[model samples]
Target: MMILGLVRWMQPVHGYDVRRELLSWGADKWANVQPGSIYHALRKLTEEGLIRAVATEQVGARPARTTYEVTPVGEDEFQTLLRGFWWGLSEPLDPFSAAFGFLPALPRSEAAAALRNRANLLRANVASMRASLESDWIRNSKPVHVGWMFELWAARAEAELSWCEQVADRVESGVSYLPAELENAEGWSAWREGGAPLDADPE
Candidate 1:
């Protein structure tokens, strides 16, 4: 959808320019639009009759560049995909959630230290995103909506950073590491076998 939208917005754009534009928007980081994948996607879209190659030219001593424009079908598809995403409630999966499920796998001290490390990383990421929002390129070259993307990212990172810090503090303070019965291998085996369900009533 991103590639189609970009092609529609910047018709007669070359693959190189497409890649550069997406990079400028930080799409590679947030949208998973890798630099190497843009050309492949362009080819695929062309093959699917969604985007058409309008021109191919070779600058002296440079590889031939193929320029593309979105087909009417591509425009329709792009709009559909965009609308679906806009109206959807999908959230990206967080690796930390999976790791946290097995928190007791590590020593309590180590687990707390790991979460603290994550908090530090989140802090750095938030700082970088905020700094990018204030950069001249973002402020001058891109449209106002582009800045909103960075704002959204910065906001999410900030929220995660706060949560990470609070959780790290709790872990460090040994809050609910586990019930005493569930701190050993036998307990874990029982839990896994459903001999002991975490949410089961004591009665």
Candidate 2:
């Protein structure tokens, strides 16, 4: 979305220049966009006829560079992608949710261990994110919205880290989960015996 909008707004920018602009704008920290992905997106958008190469220029010893300009179709697609992401209350479909749903397949001890490991990793990541936000590079270079984005990601990481600790404690303490039946046991007994998952009812 940012790529398309940038092309449209900037008008006939080279791939390298676009990426430099994006970096200056701190899209990596804010939009999670990598520099390589921006080039890929430009090539893909060109192939899709959303953006077109307008000119190729060779300046001095530098190799020929292609400058891209947005087409009418690109403008329409940009608007669609932009409008799709709105500020409103909506459930984000996270892949973590799926893994969490399937967590019962593992033994309680294994699950607790895994959750504790995850908590440790999240703690490290949250600390790194907070540090980056505080660093002069991000604080000075990024826009106010980019700062908000970092704050949001850091907050989410912290929350998830806390949840991991809580869930691990619950599993370790045996505070949650239903009474077990002979049909299902933790780890791979239920799967090996061709039954439902450990938490699932045979009925």
Candidate 3:
């Protein structure tokens, strides 16, 4: 969604150009957009009348290039999506992290499965981020600041990997899970102050 908005802002960008821009901005670290996904989104948006492709123009013996421009509706949708992105960032708990945070309340089998899934994802992401950091494009850069950005990305990936490892350890140990109702109750107080379940199931 955010990539689509950025493409709309930089009207007439080619697929390769969009891919390069996303890499340059470290979008891979923060979002899941890829070249194939970008192409899909572009086609869908165009078909929906959110964007229109300008006629391909030739500069030399090379093949012509298709450029896209956003319609007014696209502009409106972009703004709305951008605002929602910002709002989500303002929250303290990221959705993925929050799931791990509440693992103690989930069924033991389900929690273990979720932890394993998250670990696998983190492993893949960390490997990819490390590869990017070591790539010639990053290493051969003359700008000290840009080179440091790749280092930063690697560091962030490592942090996520560490968190995943910790979660996996707890899950493998068969740690007991507390009911959501008792999660926050003090040991003695919970014994004396019994009440209804903390969370009622929705019908």
Highest-lDDT candidate: 1
Query: What would the per-residue lDDT of candidate 2 be over residues 71-187, giving only the tens digit for each residue?
Result: 999989988887878744567677878987766567777888888999899889888888978888777874566666778888998999899999988777754354456335455
Each candidate structure's TM-score, on Cα atoms with residue i matched to residue i, is: 0.81, 0.75, 0.49
Candidate 2 local accuracy as lDDT? Answer: 0.79
lDDT of 1 by residue, 145-170 (tens): 88888888888888887887787787
Ten-residue stretch with the least lDDT total in model 3? 188-197
- Which stretches in model 3 have alpha-carbon errors above 4 Å? 26-30, 59-63, 89-203
State the lDDT at 46 in candidate 1. 98
Candidate 3, residues 61-88, lDDT tens digits: the string is 9877668888888888888888887677
Return whichever of 1 and 3 wins on lDDT: 1
Better of 1 and 3 by TM-score: 1
What's the lDDT of the predicted structure labeled candidate 3?
0.66
CA displacement after TM-score superposition, residue 9 of candidate 3 (Å): 3.0
